[model samples]
Target: MKKLICSLLIALPLTTHASSTLRCDSGLISLQDSTSIVSSKCGEPISREFVGYREVQDEYGFYNEVAVEEWAYGPRNGMFQFLRFEGNRLIKIDSKRGR
Candidate 1:
């Protein structure tokens, strides 16, 4: 029983960390694609969230405020994908296992 519990504890995070992958009409979309481009290709996400602004340093040691947003797509009998965008560019895509 203790082993089962320990195993479950160790596995919980791994399961939760699973995320859905993005599949575009022409295979996977390229990184740094603009949000508008993604929207055109993948259509609007199921859900959209504005995470607010963040300050980032540029190459010239200048700081700029960028808008951050998290867009969630459907589980669709599969994994749910979350797209993170900074300003208008896609920064990352995360997938989570569906229920």
Candidate 2:
């Protein structure tokens, strides 16, 4: 019983990521690609954007009732220096943390 519980605990996190991949129309890509590609496929962003970093390296998107987006950049570039879009609205994205 103790062994089963321990095994499950370890297996749980592993299963979610089972692979170092994020699905995309082109197939699996790095985590960065997962976020960026959405924009191209989905069309112009609705507004949310990231901020902080001095340079914006990548862009992302997601839309439901509201459009949401995130722009990221190389680490050390800044806290975010990226962008976020919330349905035709823009916000400085905090790449360090994303939704």
Q: Score each candidate by Cα lDDT.
A: 0.70, 0.37
Score residue 27 of candidate 2 by CA lDDT: 48
Best by lDDT: 1
Off by over 4 Å in 2: 1-64, 75-80, 95-99
> Residue by residue across 1-99, what tens digits does model 2's lDDT show?
345434334433322212233233344333334344544543333233432233333346533454455543322322222334444334333333211
Q: Which candidate has the top score in TM-score?
A: 1
- Model 1: weakest 10-residue lDDT segment is 4-13
**TM-score of every prediction relative to native:** 0.73, 0.24
Residue-pair clashes per candidate: 4, 21
lDDT of 1 by residue, 1-99 (tens): 345434334433345443234686545655688888888878877777778999989899999999998777656556666688897888888766553
Scored against the true structure, residue 71 in model 1 reaches a CA lDDT of: 77
Mind sharing the TM-score for model 1?
0.73
